[model samples]
Target: MGMHVNEVCINCDRAVADHTQKYCPNCGQPTPVHRIDWHFLGHELEHSVLHMDRGILYSLKQLMLRPGPLLRDYIEGRRGNQVKPLLLITMMSAAVVLLNRLITGGGFMDEGFSQTEAMGQALPAEALRFIAAYRSVSAWIESHFAAFTLMLLPIEALVFWLVFKRYSRLNYPEWLVVTTLLTVQTFVIWSVLVLVHRWLPQTQVLAGVLGMIYTAASLMQFFQGRPLGSTLWRTILALAIFSLASSAAVVAAVIAVMWIG
Candidate 1:
């Protein structure tokens, strides 16, 4: 609730009320907290802040569980308990992306490459290869940050549309909400793996492999309730196509950047 000025002021000075004299004669530092504006805005703002926080927590919980019921409920107008999907997903993804950049930028070059041996008759060549690989990985990641996410999300919608083409299905926007749940899950994996990699000094290959598995499992989670064999088959095939499609899109992004720059 809002604070108030006291009625007990002496009105010590005609031009300046006792509360506004050298200091707040009422509270001793400044004028007392003005009650009018606070009474008008404070309670409403406080309620809104609490409501938004509750929505965020609910959204996060559902997002962590792939193919979670939240997306369906949210998209279907049962929106009483959660934040909008795009806002919540955007905040999570942005936080992860920032963490990745910080880790990658912290003396990232040396820890990322391997050395060559005598039988590896090209120490110089191998070093160059390592550098190129490292740069490509970083470039690809930074390139994909936000602009790429917004771009690829719709592509995912199209991919799922084709996969579920025959089912008693939802509309394009519904499929998008479904796909976003999976893609947002990837950022969670990326954020965790990157943090662990920074703290533990693991091999990049180990980091990459674990990241891939997490990504795959997150996607597979949505296909639950189908036949086990069929789910596995479709998941694998869909993953393959999605990867190819994503890669092509990434390549296109690279080419376009190169052309423009």
Candidate 2:
């Protein structure tokens, strides 16, 4: 018999012999020997997340090209080839936060502070003092806006779930997935607007209009089989309810902070 050859597993770093073995015994990962060179890196990239199919790029393409059909497929139990909704949203949120920081040196904090200042004038001196003292907290929230956005995912999911419960058979978690994917799309739109804001400083209004239209369209597409008028009205009501709930929560937080201080 020929001499047995042993090779180190790239992932587990354990000795893996048996040339006939296709996977590492310790980690069960594929045993592909990749050389330490640019070509190997390129090969890995082609097979990994940068692959043309079954990767983030693929998911993003599908989302843009056929979000309704893509989401419908995922919800209807055909999720083998798609990226996880939560992962996509989380990645997109991080990308948004990073892009915002790089472009604006701050992510929404300036607007937050402007709003706070406007509100401060209406509040009592004591409340204003409290707001000033908690300015750092606001900054922290702004800096970590991505996390806060994720926190709103459940509320968004609930809005859709409640509105479409009678009209669709999907449950809350499924709605959560839908909301997450839609939010990812919104983040992409927001990123584009941020890039264009330098030339068109007044794009905020346009962004708002586009966001509303996108949400309405996405909701209608999600409930595609439903009547168009019914879907439109439910989408409007859901959006109104979500906005009110969000505003109330923000006001309540501010009041609680002032009361504590």
Candidate 3:
């Protein structure tokens, strides 16, 4: 049978003012109580998990089309329409990891690494050990990509905060939110380019370049009143600092592995 409206809400027993109303005014329960059926269960699951009406897809579209305005909207308290930033990042990271595994059958290491290994044949034993340790570290990173992405957010946010602190009024936590959205955008871009990589293997560098460009564009949009050149320069500076820090960490890890081995 089709849904039938009830004069009183089954959940709260509140008298619904309008017979045409879709939900109870008192408790916000649906006026038309659904029976326990496959249709109902599916609808409930979609509403609870995906919330496709105005959650992930909506946020992603806005981020992709107009990240600066979207970030400004959420930071300024117009957030009801968007999923939580951290949750979005976590979900996107998981999806990217899964997609990469599906496409590559496990981990997709750089093809150039093998060539580098061949060229390093004449190097000293210590240098050879370093190269091997670096490869091992890189493989571990690719396998735990999601965890590494999440771990980088705090430091990335710190870099943004330091670079833009004098110009913007947003605090460290707000910068964290900005970085989370940026990371989500990166993940979305990576997801698309990863599929393209099957046909065009050289697009990996393009993905990195596009991610940086999108990030710079996003900051430009987020700080509209500021001079575009100034925002661009600051963004470049922030990215440079973050890249150096991440590279240092990876090198340290590789060195540690060499010593242990």
The number of the candidate with the highest lDDT is: 3
Every candidate's lDDT = 0.58, 0.75, 0.83
Q: List the candidate numbers ranked by TM-score, top first.
A: 3, 2, 1
Candidates' TM-scores? 0.60, 0.79, 0.81
Flag regions of model 1 displaced more than 4 Å: 1-53, 104-144, 199-225, 255-261
Tens-digit lDDT string for candidate 1 (1-261): 323444333233223354444555544543433455667577655554345445555456566753435555666687776666677567666766677567765422245344432335456764555445545654666555566677778887777677666642667888787667666666665667668764666433454455446445544554446555654455456556777898786556555554454
* Model 2 weakest lDDT span, ten residues long: 1-10
lDDT of 1: 0.58
Which lDDT tens digits does candidate 3 get at residues 211-249? Answer: 899999999999989999999999999999998998888
Model 1: C-alpha RMSD to truth? 10.7
lDDT of 2: 0.75
- By TM-score, the better pick of 1 and 2 is 2
For model 2, how does the per-residue alpha-carbon lDDT over 149-200 read when each residue is reduced to its tens digit? 7788899889989998898888999988887888787777777877876785
User: What TM-score would you give candidate 3 relative to the actual structure?
Assistant: 0.81
